[model samples]
Target chain A: MYLCISVLVVFFQMELLTLPALRRMAICGGTHGNEMTGVYLVQEMARRQKEEGDKAWPVPLVLVLSNPRAMQECRRYIETDLNRCFTSAILSFPITDSTPYEIRRAHELNALLGPKDSKEAVDVLCDLHNTTANMGVTLIAYSPNEWICLHIYKYLKGKMTLAPVRLFMVNIPKNEAYSLESVGKNGFSLEVGPQPHGVLRADIYNYMKEAIELSVEWIGLFNSGVMIEGGEVDAYVFHKSIDYPRDPESKQITAAVHPQLQDQDFCCLKSGDPVFLSFSGETVCYKEEEALYPFFINECAYYEKGIAFHLARKTTLKIPSVRVQRN
Target chain B: MYLCISVLVVFFQMELLTLPALRRMAICGGTHGNEMTGVYLVQEMARRQKEEGDKAWPVPLVLVLSNPRAMQECRRYIETDLNRCFTSAILSFPITDSTPYEIRRAHELNALLGPKDSKEAVDVLCDLHNTTANMGVTLIAYSPNEWICLHIYKYLKGKMTLAPVRLFMVNIPKNEAYSLESVGKNGFSLEVGPQPHGVLRADIYNYMKEAIELSVEWIGLFNSGVMIEGGEVDAYVFHKSIDYPRDPESKQITAAVHPQLQDQDFCCLKSGDPVFLSFSGETVCYKEEEALYPFFINECAYYEKGIAFHLARKTTLKIPSVRVQRN
Candidate 1:
């Protein structure tokens, strides 16, 4: 008689439980082919799902492995950067004659996860990435205006007991969007790194695995009406990109980042800090005069993209605590 | 009358001194242009020489920046691997029709450091190189038959207290020499590493500088009839190269090195040891049924060159004690 009452109560509540709920969740990986950690993690996760069967995540979760062809080549991308192909300017172009490989791939991806401009997109999307630069375990919000990403960042920060919590606000203009998360309603990318392409690093891979597991748990807890604590988050807002020193007549890069600042990423640099050293013994300084934090220092992938490093400024903000009313 | 008698005695003693000695020494760098530590150290040494005159070394020393044009571009080489261009078949080819840049450079270098097959070559030549592989402070003898190279190896081994020494006998049959050290009589390449190309790592640069200094000191001391000590040298002899596991029909690489064996360079691998793991969840073991040491494991530069790793075998050989007779 007790078990019969519990089943009857659950059946009645299924139609009524509406306010605090998780409808759908998606985790995408291998958007950029060279980042193997995400690709490997997703594969491992899929294998586990196959063996463990249907009752894993509380909500309907989707797994995406984007850019399979490029990953096969072991290069960043084949035709264009798949990560940068999500904008309408690229997507609206006819996919008929001579459409690039990444463009076609982007269209296919958007049909599943996007129409990023729509208000009724997926509940959350977490993209994973790895970089050749020394930025360690970074959580990036597309722009500072993203409230849900900030909420997720805050939750992850409070939960994680290892290493550190670094959140990036990549403030691209409101009209232009170029990332996998741009296609979703909420959440941000978690980038882990300093591992080279095609090389598997154990320390980095283990940390990312832990971060992903924590993210899934946080979403489940939220759906069960568990109130998540949120507060002041120390973040860095995007400033501008710094290109390596180049020659005037022949536009080739002619200098290297000064030996002192080689691996000094996310550290403050004042005005007149020697940045590059020329072949003929000339010192080039950071001429900005304001104290700015540098990131993505000497990224190998960015070498072909002509970016030496990027600058960001420190900022502080609060993620408002979320609540759902009892209907 | 007493001073004149002493001068006469010294002049006679100099003639009586009849031991074989090193006369001319040459130190070459930038043969592979992307190795910036050697290039920077050579430039710094040259600058110091300009400031301090020629009194630093006791012998006639020459510093050759082998590939200046390639170094300007911050690349490995211009036309061909300059290190590979010193062989007779290429060197003896006609320079008129369409000789490659490195081959022409090799001809010029031969006029200076070589005529390598002849007896009148530089008595000792030290080539400085750096790799993206995890080989730290390596002393490379072209083949094990080189007696003087072994003697020099023993001397450098006794000098360095920080790092363990690795000497590679890059086995090419008995003929067809392919290194810058192949031209000169009695020295080997001092390789420092795990540093990326075109990046100047201060720690690696300092270690190379110290290694170069000790090399020059060894040559100078040997010329003055020094009795150098020799003992058992732990050496790794080249076996063969191992390419990444690939699909036979598809011509694509299928796997990555196993997580446990990622950075296990210069370490022994026995039978049944998991070496490579496929994406489809299969482990490739070392099926050699014997123990072997792996070197240059997961080198970034060699990824494009299609080498997964190189195999070597460890051997203990005594470098015959070198003694120069005194008058």
Candidate 2:
């Protein structure tokens, strides 16, 4: 009888620590107006919602087209990048008549779906994006320990057949996270590409659409009392970014990504590998001491940010199996 | 004695009608600032001129960066597209303080190299450009009868081993022409692509470089009084452009270029071929009854211009062999 009582005590403790079921979610796009896949996907969802109502979704879903003005103009942003205006400090800034359009929009978005770090925040958020780099489909999250995002990444990787799926962890604190996806209790970004800005490709659009559908399916399964089994996932952790070789006086780029390195994202680079080809027909070699994987190679949008590419360290992350807790 | 006098008279008549040797040439780039191959090729040539002096060229050459402000911002244009601002009517407009930057720059370019229909204009002009379409290497001209340009196109087609070379005739009248290359006596644009705007690829840059070098070599040979042989050349004549499917209410694009059609520039399209894929996964087929070649498929910069792709008619032109005239 004493042994039976001890077993019951342990079961009670396990129930207290179980995660709650996610009741609300948000999907956003057009944070950068030039990225067309996201813009179209969000628009498509909104059209369906208007025609059929929200009964189609298992969870209450909010569809957001961030930076409407930028999307209308078909530009990246008006004053500053909207994706970078979501940090706690930027969001709390007082509104002024002279404030940029994006910052003001950020506040409106936070009020509607975020109020971040609070219990009222949506359970999941997925912001869609596109890149000119040949990185295939990538899931970007702020933390490696975000089990919800990691499990979704694993689910997407298993289900997606057209392209390789990968996870990229930015590893920043929640308060310091700058992207629109960071506003939810469990948030991440879905980035797919090899597409140019302001241009849409049918293959790329299909990849993004498939990912969203799979993510929603996973969410519905978990909510309906299905325990999702989790395992190890290979994730790329952000290391550093490198800029193109530039002229000293003019600060204009003096070279381009080497032919060998161009379009070769997520490939390991070691010392003495050719990285750039100078306009004068000379090759520039990588000089780093250690080998690292590079992604976002020659992304069109990041040219303004002075990033030719980003390097990361690949690591295996162990995620815990999860099931929605009963009230 | 009578036969000798007749031959002398015919020779004299031919000398009077012979075309003048090209003495001055201009090469311009950055008319669309985001086309990086042109911007870098012009920069590289300027650097060589600065380091090697005028002795590097057999003819007096002028290198121009057509849109400095746009290049600095890495945008297609700041206020208006510079490429579309070169019509005679636009160039003659009175300059006001509020005049668009591109127009002001156009006037500056006109005064420096053009004075369009005058003897003082550069003998030959080659404007460099890049497109996001998989167009290989293209020489765009206003008239198929322009012997100098046709011969250059033929020469480039024979010499360029990296990519296929073809001629695209805009077929517009000189006074109504709206491009920087129209400012010269015998002018055409060398366009190469499949590279994204604001990003450079080593292969694309090399193709542009090789084309430019071969053009210069052809000019030098003609100036040195060597006969250039010409033959039948195939050129695409502009027909019409088709816009993407759009929503009636919002006027936003509702479909994207189908995967089957994307990157298949210069391919023949017939009735009932897949052309676009709607956001909801429906395939839209081509409805034109006649077969035609399509080029500039899904160009990034043309989204705002409402052009999904351009249709053209391919025709063969017979070009004549010629040698430069000597005084």
Candidate 3:
């Protein structure tokens, strides 16, 4: 049963005629061990899939449990942050005395699900994450302008009607992408949060499972040549990563994000609005002239890295084509 | 500034004229290492106290960082649940071949806070804890029949106006008290929750710190012979620990607390109300007739010990004669 379907597939390009079909999809979880949202969701999906006797995705899914040891320890990572270890440059570095647990895990995962740059690599990837930041159902796009990525966002928005999907475009400096999704050909990371690192909120857990299963279903549908609608999604584009106010003397974060602005993530921030408040009772305000949105406020995992929040700008993403292939 | 004061501090027996002032109160935190509400709250309180320079407590306090090394690792405990490690029977077993890390710490703590049956021990103690259960500002009383326990309940209820206080009376067989506060003459354990272990929620942290500081102030006021109003507090008294529905063959818990009952802790439960739902699509209803209350639903840490929830009965506690001596 081979069928030719015309759809706008993202090949890292925005084109109406690109009709590439999803060959294989990989759903990676426990990329950072303490991110239990992905870890449990992946485990549940696998259990359910096995129990139901292989109602497998028409396109095979490579389930990667990136760091089992770290998950067991209930720490973010046993050594280095796994989420930050998946770069070609880092992978090329020799496994040395200083190489951490996650760095080695990344090399293994890349071997299993990658080399994502090769022709036989998985067609698409979806990495799951949870955060202490109140980022409700966030989709971070590594390939934002492409058709397949936009369609995935549109399908996710449609299925998760109650849990709105907010999109963030990933724009890092030249030669510095450090996410698991970056190792895949076409993919994005889904983050649901305000959940702490080592714990699973059942509500969030169920929702994330749904998000993951739906992605697999969507991939199956794509494999079956199902006509997907090219729809528009509102995304808060990445502008810059904002860090916590650090003390000059000790280099430690000395301020907390202002209470009012604490979880008002992705909301428009006006100039002169209070942002961070120091232990000494000094307030840091948003001094930018243009109104910007903020998210990832007080992410617990980011404490060591000093990221208080990320600044973003609201933008509309349009997807105008849809097609797939089946055989 | 020596002051003569005589407060009717309950000496285990509510003798109306037993005028023993609250000479010293011990505030213990991290009784369970992963309970970050106590850990962070205690840390914050200690930091604030040191920074503000001794605003000396009238009653004097001994602050115990109950399990510092365990807290450093962010686990419930290094070897055993520290809350369950304080019994005299266990502590008296001596340093043996099987002594775990927490057991040694318990011996050290007993030497510091106890000789539980001695006069030199702290007159009152309040241990702080956090749970994954959706319990908000709970007070667990070792001796619910005593006057001091009821008074503490009344005071906490009055103070935590936005967040109500729920009470659980600790009633175990003779010679078994599983908490640090049990060693003190008069005290209770305060638990704030639904916050995951090893993570800090700002809101919960602030509330817990407020609860801790208020407890200290109340102790100080008691020492100063402040006349407190005799009020009544509604408490949900502990009845039984409820386990989740388990599969008969595997003996594994196969059900989760029903959505309606998950976080509806301390709410009245009628006979036949849905309590748990099995993976096999069966609903386990609350089959008891007389109206009862439920709390401590779905505590994450309790999963290992097989507790799904707890049943309680609501009752009014009266704190009638509130008088103290002063000169």
lDDT of 3 by residue, B132-195 (tens): 6778888888655656667767777778754767788766632478678877877688889767
Q: Candidate 3: deviation at residue B327, Å? A: 9.6
Greater DockQ among 1 and 3 belongs to 1
Candidate 1 local lDDT, B265-290, one digit each (tens): 88899998988877555789889976
Per-residue lDDT tens digits for candidate 1, residues A161-220, read: 764668988878534878777777775888887776655555567667778878887777
| Residue B291 displacement (Å), model 1 | 7.1
Candidate 3 yields a Cα-based lDDT of: 0.73
CAPRI tier for the interface of model 1: incorrect
The two-chain DockQ for each candidate, comma-separated, is 0.22, 0.69, 0.19
- Name the top lDDT candidate: 2
What class would a CAPRI assessor give candidate 2's docking? medium
Considering only chain B, what TM-score does candidate 3 achieve?
0.89
Question: Which candidate number would show the highest DockQ if scored against the true structure?
Answer: 2
Docking quality class, candidate 3: incorrect
Prediction 2 global C-alpha lDDT = 0.89
TM-score between candidate 2 and the true structure:
0.94
The order of the candidates by TM-score, greatest first, is: 2, 3, 1
